[model samples]
Target chain A: MTDYSPLLLSLKVAGISTFFVFIFGVFFAHLFSRKKFFGKSIIESLFMLPLVLPPTVVGFGLLILFGKNGFIGSWLLNWFDFQVVFTWIGAVIASIVVSFPLMYQSAAAAFESLDARMENAARTMGASNWRVFWTISFRLAWPGLLAGLVLSFARGLGEFGATLMLAGYIPGKTDTIPMAIYFAVESGQMEKATFWVVIIVALGFSTIMWLNWWSRRNIERYKNDNA
Target chain B: MLEVQIKKKLPHFLVDINLTVEDEILVLVGPSGSGKTTILNAIAGLDHPDDGRITLNGNIFFCDNEKPLPTQQRNIGYLFQDYALFPHMTVEKNIAYGVKKMNAIEAEKRIERLVNTLGINHLLSKYPHQISGGEKQRVALARALATEPSLLLLDEPLSALDSRTRLECQEELQRLHATWKTPFIIVTHDMQEAEKLGDKIIFLESGLITKTVDNRSGKMIC
Candidate 1:
């Protein structure tokens, strides 16, 4: 009997991580896109570190931060009796850390592309800053933001090294699709590994196709609207 | 009365001007980069002047020493060169955006009146992207007028329209101005448009007002 728990768990981790990633990504993008301050580049570089660092390095860093005896982990354990290490929650964290840069970069690009005049027009018409952001800025940049969301979700789904170091490989509890595939190939179960690989490839392809379709539809709609 | 005395240092030159206007169309006629739009932006509080004061009807809109009221509270209507309509919103929503302080029924009534006056009633449910250039201009004008501001600033209002559409919009603007009874400052490079619409035309050259022509008698005042 083939267990499909790994695939389900991987989807769950990716979905939850993407939610947090989307919020932070858009918020930081909105913040950084409009202002220039001291240490702006430094702050931006720190958020982008995970994308450049090797997966093993990122995983090891997370392990040190969230281990039971570690700073945050120890506080949580003592006060709330809640543990994150070697659990599915740890997997979600790892996924978020690994995938956040993709979301942030794309969102920032989208925000930067917006016309400053449009926002200024809203303000001159007596719309507050908050209302202008929601009504004008976010609405215009939705296409690029949605694309970033999909990319981050894909990145989270494929997370391997961070998940291994933080969540570990516990079947039906923490083992994700990538981890299952790794263990299957290591034990010479090529057929089992192949099955998971096929599933992942199919999912990735469908996402790309969907993204292309969405972009094409938007272009056609724009043409029709303007015509 | 609107009183403006401001000095802004641009990269190319210094923009220093002092002017007063009443309920008349005051046109800033100049070439591109002559600081015409800059004056409009400064009045709307979209751009800050290095040091100056702007007062409208005894209310101080901006004073360099004091914290200027933000753009949202300035109660100025600004029509951008491209109209700058919110592309995602319907024509009605865009017109009603600034009237958030009004009750829903009052807002709806205002929107209905403006839409009918602007002849955009049929386009109320359509997004900006779905409208033609003339329709977009009408919608933008309605949006700017919906809030009942004391002052109106327009930057190159007819520059984006084709010849035929521009003539129609120009007539529409003149008709609206007759009833609105607010001080208007319009920036334009087209001399004909300036002569036709302006009661007092300020000719700017190199960021300074070289001449002020009173078009009321079809003669140059300077």
Candidate 2:
């Protein structure tokens, strides 16, 4: 008998986490790319921390922050009797924290490459700041932004360490594909573990293939439109 | 009338200029780094003058004591040296961009008139990267004029075109000016272009006007 709860849970967690990551990632990317102020480098570096930190390190940090007696954990326990630790919400948070930098880096690079003169031309022609961003900057940066979207979604889908630390393995509740695979192997259920490994590899491969096809199609459409 | 009296410090020298133009072309001719584009940028509110006042037809654009009017509200049409056409947009879309305040019918009518006037009717559907340099220049000009700005500034408007296209575009520019009759301030390094297009030419060096030539009267005014 095959259980599909882990697959469904993994997709739900990644989908939710990617949604939040996209909004914050693009927003912060634009802010960091366009504006300059105090402590900008430090703040940007902090955002990039999860990318370089070992998975266990990230998981350990999340544990410290969300563990009972921790600041947010204690407050949540006292207020709503709701604990994020060992729950689906914890998995979403962990995925977001781990996958954020991928989106941020791609979006920032996209924005940084935009020609300032084109933006200035829009401004002199009486386009508002908001209009310029939407019509010009965002449109021009779409390709790179789309790449970030795929990378972050994939990262979120594969998130394991932080999820394991925060959202423990519980069948039909917190058991995601990665958690299921790990436990199945530890318990000598090689067939189940192999099944999950194959599924994850196929998912990752298809995601990347879709991104490439989408990018090429977009470029072709752009050229055809111009022609 | 466009009035400019501004001072700004540059890396090499201080740019100090006081000039005015009314329904005529005023050309700033100088060496590469003599702050010609800087003056145009200041007038367009793209860059600030460290100290001074700029008024277009009596509306204040910038003053030391008052907050500078943002570029969006300045109603100044600037044709950049590189044309600065939006690559992703078609020629017609680029021209129509600055005229969003008008209803679709009126905006379409305006765009039609501009493309016809600039002879870019054939290239309306083409994007910036797909057009020739001359076509790009004409499209950019149409865009600048789309808003019916009270003042027009050109920064090396013909520098990128070949000699043949440059000559043709220069004549087209004069014809457009005659029809529009707004204040025109053009920056150029070519003395011949200054003579051809300018009613008043100011020769600048190290950020100061070294000489002034009234091209209409052919009189030297130092």
* lDDT, residue A208, model 2: 98
Report the first chain's TM-score for all candidates.
0.95, 0.93
For candidate 1 chain B, which ten residues in a row score worst on lDDT? B99-108
Question: What TM-scores do the predictions have?
Answer: 0.95, 0.94
**Consecutive 10-residue window with the lowest summed lDDT within model 1 chain A:** A218-227
Give the DockQ (C-alpha) for candidate 2.
0.58
Scored against the true structure, residue B10 in model 1 reaches a CA lDDT of 95
**CAPRI verdict (incorrect, acceptable, medium, high) for model 2:** medium
CAPRI-style class, candidate 1: medium
Which pairs clash in model 2?
none
The DockQ value obtained for model 1 is 0.71
